[model samples]
Target chain A: MQIVLAIVIGAAFGAVLDRIGATNPTVISGMLTLRRIRLMKTILLAIGTGSILMFAGQMAGLVDVGHMSVKTAYVGVFIGGLLLGAGWAASGYCPGTGVCAAASGRKDALFFVAGGLLGAAAYMATYPAWKASGLLDGIAGGKVTLGAVPGSKFDGLFAISGDLLGIVLGAVFVLVAFVLPDNLTGGKTPAEVPAE
Target chain B: MTLDWKLGGVLLGLVFFAAVLLVKPIGVSTQFVILNGIVTDVVNPEFITQTDEGYTSTNAYMAKSNGKYAKNAANPVNYSFIFVLAMMAGAALSAFGRGLDREDKRLPAIWKANFGDTPWKRYAVAFLGGFIVLYGARLAGGCTSGHMMSGMMQTALSGYIFAAGAFLAAIPTAMMLYKEG
Candidate 1:
């Protein structure tokens, strides 16, 4: 029964992604070019909404934060983050988006997948050398969460959370949504863009 | 011909449930192990020694290593493969419903002109891209599906990192390759 439900959910997610034009490389590229803000808005909304839900769930005792697995601290993660940011700007589609794009039968997505697979294989082939390095060494601290932060990660994070930082940043995204000119937009919905 | 959002929803739900029921959970990162195991066996079969009672075969080795080298790896007949297959089927079904599956001659023309008009380059690049992502996924210990979707669902910090890294990588890569005419 659960299995059936999962499949349905997965399929729906794909459909929503398609409907949103997320599977399109142009849509994603538009976010960076400021030609399309829909992707950014959609992504921000998803993240913000999901975060709020989880926060509320935890406070209400409906969920436990302790059970979750967290990565040990690594400088590599930060470097990887920068590389990823650069890659996305260059590629236009990340893994999920790439998969969806491929499913949609888009040809460009084929290259995206090709680049991704090569990157993965390269990482594996070089893992032993990397693991031996001090930079990638793992710290003992495990299961860290936002609640532990002295300054909230959410703060200045689009500015809507009651928490001062969250409210500030959360609000920025909303403000950007409202104030940015259509051309200068950081994110927009699929309906806002011209069709490919 | 319109997408039945409800049907898409049902298929997604089935995939997740099927994964949990049969293979513990759904995430694309695990596929790396299967690929890795295959590479390992092919590259150096002598290194692929039997470690457990249930999985004493090469096939078992492939699945087990892919799943965090988990002992008692989930059955090969699990839903990950099935879910991917179903996704393709659903996409095809939706395309057919929309009358959009018909071949566009121009599509091939674009590919021929840009991608060297050779099958080998296309396949090689595809394989290389897959390899890169798998490597990153392993280094990060998860993929976008595992770390981003599942990880964020659980609110793990690493999930955020994974998501950030993936999006970060994707945007630039696309621009470099796809921005041209």
Candidate 2:
């Protein structure tokens, strides 16, 4: 029952992402280019909204916060973030968006997905060699939470509180959707678009 | 016709509900360990050791110190990992079914000019990018999934910082690439 629910929910979220023109490389790239802030706004809305809901749910006893996982590795995170950013720029798709794009039938997305899988496989293949020198490993902190790590818990509380903010932001996104006309994305190239 | 909001909504609802029901939560970082186990099993059996060092057992360094594989080969595809994979697949199926399957060809002029005809360059770039991301993900102790989804869900401070880190890198990389394009 639970697994079935999981699939159904994920699929729906994917659908919304697809409909919103999120899976398109052009749209995501546009966010960076400043041609379109839609993607950025949506991401902010989702993060802001999602966090708030989760917090509220936990506070209400509707959700179990302990089962949730969190870890802190400042060095690894800082570096990994740099790499992920570089990759997203060059590839025009992150892991979530790539999957969504592929489903939307983009050839580039297929490459993106293939690359992710192969890259994952590659990481595993090299883990042993990388691990041998202890260059990649660091002190393991069990499950550091807002309470455990450095930094004010206020921000953590703010994230949950942001749920109310998400409502306002989400409405704004809808407004942007209306104001921005379609074909803001240039149409398909001659080769990509099928001839009549 | 109404954006299938009902369908999308129901599915998303299910994701949250199901997560709470089964895995007690959902996350993506564990998938890396499973992949590591599978790849290690196939590529280098000698890499895995046999020892017990608690959570450190999963750390590449501690694994070496304790004499065990960084990822427990005994259970590579843990139920949680499988759940994450399933979520991706489920989302794919739903989106693809709606006739939304098409690429947006908003290529930056440079890429279009230099490698427009060839897909391999982009593919190579994508592959290279993944390598960098995984190495980072491993070091970060979690990918976007574990940190963003699970960590944030728990209201952990690191989750927020990691999320910020991902965006911080993402914004600049996007700027450079798109500008070049």
Q: Quote each prediction's TM-score.
A: 0.64, 0.66
CAPRI level of candidate 2: acceptable
State the number of backbone clashes in model 1.
101
Candidate 1 residue-wise lDDT, A1-196, digit = tens: 4446435554655555565445544455556655555455554444334344444444455534332344444556545555544554444455665666566676655766666756755665566676677657653333333334223232111223333332333344345434545454343433443323
Poorest lDDT segment (10 consecutive residues) of candidate 2 chain A: A187-196
- Cα displacement (angstroms), candidate 2, residue B37, comes to 2.4
lDDT of 2 by residue, B5-58 (tens): 334333333444445434454455445455556565567665554545532343
- Candidate 2: pairs in clash: A8-B11, A9-B11, A9-B12, A9-B15, A104-B101, A104-B102, A105-B101, B49-B68
Report fnat in order of the candidates.
0.22, 0.34
Error of 1 at A86 (Å): 3.9
